[model samples]
Target: MDYQSIKNILFKFEPETAHHIAATAFELASFMPPVLNALQKRYLVTSPLLEQDIFGKKFANPLGIAAGFDKNATMTKTLHALGFGYVEVGTVTPKPQTGNPLPRLFRYPRYEALQNAMGFNNDGAEIIKKRLERIYPADFPIGVNIGKNKTTPQAKALEDYRFLIENFKDLADYLVVNISSPNTPNLRDLQNEQFIKDLFIMAKDITSTPILLKIAPDMSPEQAVNLTATAVEAGADGIIATNTSIDYSLLKGAKDFGGISGKVIKDKSFAIFKEIAKELFGKTVLVSVGGIESAEEAYRRIKAGANLLQIYTAFIYGGPKLIADINKGLIEALQKDGYEHISQAVGADIR
Candidate 1:
């Protein structure tokens, strides 16, 4: 049956349960290379126009499955088969901790949104590092997003990130330092300049892997730009323009806790992204993620100076066909704009 029909049934379960069910299916799929190849043949789009080198690695397309989906690095090949150009796994802590309490993942189907207080639940850095070692040299790029353990004190947070970076720096094509998730206590507090400078400087001293900072949407556009500027200056290789947003006003009856993502946060996410792009687009790599749900929106982000785009909530809502449709639509949009390559279209609006 179609994905929507499958989703209808899955939606009946709690959102977290549905996610586990999906992950289980992917685990099964991993045992069958033929099944994966067949899926890739259908879903994976390829064209020179969409290809580019970022972080010194070739990304077959600009779109990736965002970090939260594959927290332990198990779903890379499965996600690639589903047509993601890349997969970023984790929010992995120095040590594994059961994330916030249950009932943590909630869905708002009508709004194509999700509110999650999942708090970086994942197999810790060592386990995830082992997984990456087994899967590296795969066809697509991989990124590992690292966070501090819940019990790790804020003062020791740098130590957590340090350990994670040292572990996965060689395994991942890129590393993301996640200090923006609202679910982790005091994580957002690290968004300040001094912490960012220290973190990136320490990270650079440890590994040469391109490290990006994932910021939150709650900060003002100016604040976002200033903080990211600090990160870039401090040797961060890129910026992932948002994680989930803590602004509950975006959704009616939204739980006041956790962060909100998907369609509801699109405009707010873009506004911050656009402002950041306006200042730093050419200076540093900018990766945009938040509430993107269509080829049109993806193209809009590209024109606004995103070197890469990521989706999690929309991928849940749209499924495999959505990935193919986006790559196809991007080609059409690029041809219509008289751009020979996606790079030409990358900052068309700003240029």
Candidate 2:
């Protein structure tokens, strides 16, 4: 296999199955050092120009495969081999979860997007923590995204989050508090100022893991500003702007209910990035994701104030080559603007 052939074969299977097969195949390939090296030489772009320092950690490149792709941390090494500078694994809950019923993941090839109500499905934080411990690497930065189980109520959400933090604090490179996924009932409601402050306080006391809050794109500008302020005041290390959008007005006749991601959310993602940039003013790191299918869009987001950029839908549409291409485009974009590094370009477009 070639990329498209493998993609076609995977596409023939159901969406969730294809995801599993791909992840497992990559995990198998990761053991072959020669193969992994060849992939890195071909796909992973390492240039001093692309290096970035955020949240007290240095990234070899600013591109990361956003959370949800590898929910179990089984293929982090392989994904890194495929050119992602970093890999974020799991929306791992405190306990194992079956997630929403079948047909949970739907693909809209026409829109170059996917709508999934996976409901934080994973093998649990303990399992993921053990797997991560077995593959520990000094240089690899693996961020773990933590979520509450479906049975966990809104009232006790903090306890669920703290449980994972306490268990995986030493195992993960950083921690992401994912409260924006549309699949979980009332999950996004935690974005409220009071709730967010309370959650952060709990997270703060448990460990020193850099904590970031992930927010949805459907929020109003006022909501975005308020959330950003709340996170900053609560001592959040960073923010992952504009998670998958629930505003399917664009997909009105196409699909019913689920989070929408891809080109449809590009402008919205950028607008939220800009709003957070203006309000935070480089006080906290911003990881932008949504609608970035090409280098031009990635460059635009970095210029808009994202210290780091992540992709999921684009990886599905563009294949593995997209990663190297975006890094190449980013280097060019930086040169065009007379900047010496990626950090110099952050927030260049915003006044």
Candidate 3:
């Protein structure tokens, strides 16, 4: 049956429960090579036109599954099979976290959005590191998105990130420093210039693995540009334009807590990303996330200076077909625009 039919049944359960059910399917598929290969054959879209090398890795396509969907490393193989160019796992912490109280994940199907207050819940770095050791060095790229523990004081947040970076640097093709998640108390406060400088400096000292900074979309274009510029100047290899947004009004009947993502935040995210891109596009690798739902949006991000693109909520709503559809649509769009390769379109608008 189709994903929408499946989603209709899945939607009957609470969002978190439905997510676990779906995640379990991917986890199980990892052990079955036949299932994986089959999924890849049907969903995976690869073309020389879409292929680009970033951070010394070959991304078969620019589209990737953003960090939160595969918070643990279990789904990497399956996600790749489902046509994601890369899979970013974890918002892992120094310690295992239960996250916020239950009922923390909610879905707004009409808006194609989700609000999650899940605060860095994961199996912790030690466990996740072991998981990656067994699974890393795959044909595709894998990124580990790390964050500070909830109980860790803001004063000690640097140490938490330092520990996570040290543990994951060798395991992941790249690493993402996730200080901008809105669920963690005082996490966004760490987005300051001095702290970003110190964090990237410490990361550079540890491993040469390309580390990128993930920021929130709640800031002004000016703040976004300044903060990202600071990150790149301080040795960050790339920047993921945004995490999720805390702007509740974007979706009517929104929760006062957690962060909102998907269709509702598209314009907000694109505006901030465009501003950041105008200033820092060529200075570092640029990744655009938040509310990317189609080929047109993906192309817009590329032209606006995104070297890579990621999707989470859209995947939930649009299902697996969306992945291949986007890659195919991107190819068509690029050819129609008189571009031979995806790289040629990167920052076309900015140039």
Residue pairs in collision within model 1: none
Model 2: ten consecutive residues of lowest lDDT = 249-258
Candidate achieving higher TM-score, 2 or 3? 3
Tens digit per residue, CA lDDT, model 2, 113-154: 788778888998778888988876536678889998889988
- Whole-model alpha-carbon lDDT for candidate 2: 0.85
Which runs of model 2 end up more than 4 angstroms from their true locations? none
Task: Work out the TM-score per prediction.
Answer: 0.99, 0.96, 0.99
The candidate, 1 or 3, that scores higher on lDDT is 3
Relative to the unseen true structure, what is the Cα RMSD of model 1?
0.8
Count of clashes in candidate 3: 0
lDDT (Cα atoms) of all candidates against the true structure: 0.92, 0.85, 0.93
- Name the lDDT value of residue 317 in candidate 1: 94
| Candidate 1 local lDDT, 82-179, one digit each (tens) | 98999998989988888998899999988999999999899887788888888896778999899999999999999999898988888889999999
- After superposition, candidate 3 runs with Cα above 4 Å error: none
- Candidate 1: stretches off by over 4 Å: none
- In candidate 2, how many Å is residue 199 off? 1.3
